[model samples]
Target: MRTDMPAEIWLDPYRWEALQEILEQDGTDIEEVLQNYLIEVYSDRVPIERQKEVDRRIKKERLAAVQEAEARKVFCAMHIREHGQEYILMEKNGREFLQVAVFLRRYLRNEFTTPPQRVRPGI
Candidate 1:
């Protein structure tokens, strides 16, 4: 259940040279080379169940990112409709405009809760 995972690896000069040599060998594609390297490097450190969990989490994150991107697109379109394309472009280039934009965007999308009205007696 580790949330912080390393996305990349750094290989020293000698190992990198060896990897390049392997890549240059006949009929060896990058996918095969990397797969072999991963097996050699992490085969013992990670179990099959852990690898499956990591893959699942990666997929879930990717799907969430796509959904968030779609939602942002919808919010942007709503903003443009409410305040024209020219105004949107003008605000887009301004410093700290994103803070305002996010507030307006969420408001336009009805993502914020409406405040309760104060009651005046016998209105």
Candidate 2:
């Protein structure tokens, strides 16, 4: 969301391109390549010097995925702790909908606070 940060940190065009190439290669396992890339490319930290290019591409989807996963975990825990299989229903435009909207509304309030850590391993 911050424009000052470099793009590649989230969006690795090179890695993606590499994956594309590997996909085209005979007998090249794309999954293996992706696994290796994740392990090798991000296992350490992205240097500040390289952050411009590396961090620039960090995608919102990645952050959203991380955030959503965390939110779901928290939401489920809260639901189990605070409210069991209890659900309410409301008719909106003659459509009955399971209304846990209030819970979700509250969950979203705290969801963005604890973002996934700086996942750039090489930094």
Candidate 3:
């Protein structure tokens, strides 16, 4: 799974604006034009055999990932559904889980705070 954000290519604002205006004169989006341009450049540079091998690997990996996700959904549906049963989760010795809890607490501290108590009418 590709979970990380893509890297950005910074462009000169003035040149980019001029190029964008020219590109959009034909009702074309800059992103679409850039993507097509990249594909054209890659095709011109890379051999057909190498590109085919890379495409095959990408397809295999993505399909395997999709199948694993579907299997996880099936397992959860079969075993983890709401019921009258009690389940206790056991954690292996790891700081990762503890760190996640601490991070969550810091992120959501406002939500967990109690409201101030009301004062008595007559003290």
Number of the top TM-score candidate:
3
The predictions' CA RMSDs to the true structure, in order, are: 13.1, 16.6, 13.9
Which clashing pairs does model 1 show?
none
TM-score versus the correct structure, for each prediction: 0.36, 0.18, 0.50
Tens-place lDDT per residue, model 3, 51-92, is 999889888889999999766652111111124433222223
- The local lDDT score (0 to 100) that residue 79 gets in candidate 3 is 18
TM-score head-to-head 2 vs 3, winner: 3
Candidate 2 residues 1-123, lDDT tens each?
A: 344322233448798778668687766665565666775765467666676665556676469777977665522212222333333222223221344555455445645354322323332
Q: Choose the strongest candidate by lDDT.
A: 3
Clash count, candidate 2: 22
How many clashes show up per model? Answer: 0, 22, 0
Error of 1 at 96 (Å): 20
lDDT of each: 0.59, 0.49, 0.60
TM-score of 1: 0.36
In candidate 2, stretches whose alpha carbon ends up further than 4 angstroms from where it belongs are 1-54, 74-123
Candidate 3 has a TM-score of 0.50
Which window of 10 residues has the lowest lDDT sum in candidate 3? 74-83
